[model samples]
Target: MLVQVNFLGEASGCYSGGMQSQSSQSNKARRRKEGLPAITPEAICDAAISLTKEKGLEGWSMRDLAAELDAYVRVIYYHVGDRDAVTSLVIERVLSEVAIPSAASGWRAWFDDLLRGLRDVMRRYPGVAKRFALVGPGGHAARAIAETGISLLREAGFGELSVPAFSLLLEQTCQFVAQEDDRDALPSLRKSAASEYAACAGVPGGMGDLSKSVAHATTSESSLRRYYDDSFDFFLRTVLDGLEVRLSNMRG
Candidate 1:
């Protein structure tokens, strides 16, 4: 009788300890809830976009996102595969916001509008432009934008050269503005550019004086943005003019 009483007490103590442990570990990692409003891929993407907008693409992690969703990190994986998957979704979301203008006023006007719209979208997303430039959009929106851009080139008499033309324009515009979204990076970049230019100035066998001067001018945030925008516009117009030159050569 004494042994049985002791056994019951020990068993009760073990049960109590186990329950306490489970309760304490309830919110760790893959903690499932009863009704989570049906976590969809779209829902996961939305949360991820929101998070990236608040924190730069590199700032947030899977665990951080899961915490924001009040779910386990595993739940996010189930919906969106992984961090790259989330980034792809964000890129698609950002691209979808850019309006594809019709060639209403002419191909040049349309192209101008398209680039302006793209710049506006990239500026709105801050650090997103950098990520997009690095990742190079693997989503459907990327395909659509490329197709539309190539069609514009075709309209402008790019004919056989449309493919290369579209490629240059797309890469140049994204890379140019992507560098501009980096507000934090600009100040340091400016200082570095000034120092480097000063070091290189009038130094034989160095970057020519004019190139160094231009580099120095591009360091400050405001100057950097203006320089980027001016350079991008010049590049766009030059490429468009080249397409015309290509057409002329073909005709000749």
Candidate 2:
């Protein structure tokens, strides 16, 4: 299979050379201020994470992050390609914080704790869930989480070949909660969507009632906090019960 190449695009061999000639030195010189803290990739990642926490994935920009770090936008660019690059690093930092338990609590308990812990982290950081919505097991932290989940399922007698598939399902479920983990915007959205859906009901069937679904989402913080808490118990149990049934049938 042949792949199309764009000479003018980011992946081109000369891209770095062109960029260096244009602004590399100037960008470095701008950050050469006295008494200012050093700007390293790790520091940038930390600052990016903090900025995301204050606003959100979409809430913060490269310029916002630069301002936060007391550096120029080009300085940020020098470190990372763009806002997406910063967010990717931020996601890595977020996922790395999750530690797999040293002992097993059985598959169900393990997954429940794992999922809850991940959601808790996302809620604390604000934009992490949104950033990792499409982050599919690329980085080590995320891959390790998936691997841990897969191994637990295998030990629980799930189909050996099925672990990776199940990991995707688990990730999707986690992403669902994480994406909706928007503590700031979701409450007002919940209220507005409910009202809008109510008004739209009994009207002509023009567009689909999308807000109808959004309205079903819990509005209160307590409810959102329990979005996984109360319901995931039901969900996790249901899955385990079904799997046990499957395992028993296969045994017979």
Candidate 3:
């Protein structure tokens, strides 16, 4: 037997509990007459994506999403289940947009290209990069990327270390992106920190070179973003170089 929805209960219900009656025949007919589009999992996921792009993945709640769709909170639960479910769909959608580069570019170059692209995509969605860094990817798109990455490493002589090597490369890149996302979220704190770093360069008996470099990198928005890019590139290249050395050691 199908579950009965208490539409009246929904008006005052908690988001996690009540069933929405929007799927009832009478309500469906009413919605059609009002010209409201039918809600589906895809439509819910699409609205979630829009919310994520505007407010980051962690920023919005189920009520915010319902408001975005002009639907009741229970409607979201009725269609997509819960916040975690919607997040998974949002992650899948974001991952699908990242173009995996051709492996013909060789392992190092392929990763260089792939990581840059991944950063570009993840940065757009804010908290997503941090999620990836913390939990790694979960969906089929992630699996596809991982399969290719591991294959590339194995072919590059990482042998049985391919999985860890791939994990490290991707994790480090995502962590960098995550830091950027965090820093962007607190502009006042960032500016205060930047100001302190800049002041350090002017200290008597100056720490000159190191402090100057830090100050220059942190002093402005454009410089900071460029600093992140340049720093990530340097970090990625250094890891690739170290891995190359490790591969040689394994061979010897």
Cα lDDT tens digits for candidate 1, 100-149: 88756766677778877898887766667777666577646578778777
- lDDT by residue for model 2 (63-134), tens: 888888888776665555566666667777877777566436876677667766776677767756655665
TM-score versus the correct structure, for each prediction: 0.69, 0.70, 0.86
Ten-residue region with minimum lDDT total, candidate 2: 1-10
| Residue lDDT tens for model 3, 1-252 | 122222111212233323334344555587689998887777888898898889998999999998988777766666566676677778788888888999998998888889889989998898998888888667454887898889999998898899999999989998989898888899898778767777788665557566778889886678888898888889888999999899999999
**Sequence-dependent TM-score of model 2:** 0.70
Report the CA-based lDDT of candidate 1 relative to the real structure: 0.67
Error of 2 at 80 (Å): 3.0
lDDT of residue 15 for candidate 3: 36
Q: Which is the winner by lDDT between candidate 1 and candidate 2? A: 1
Evaluate all candidate structures by whole-model CA lDDT and list the values in order: 0.67, 0.63, 0.80
lDDT pick, better of 1 and 3: 3
CA displacement after TM-score superposition, residue 225 of candidate 3 (Å): 1.6
Q: Look at candidate 2 and give me any clashing residue pairs.
A: none
lDDT of 2 at 75: 60
Model 2 / residue 230 / CA error / Å: 1.4
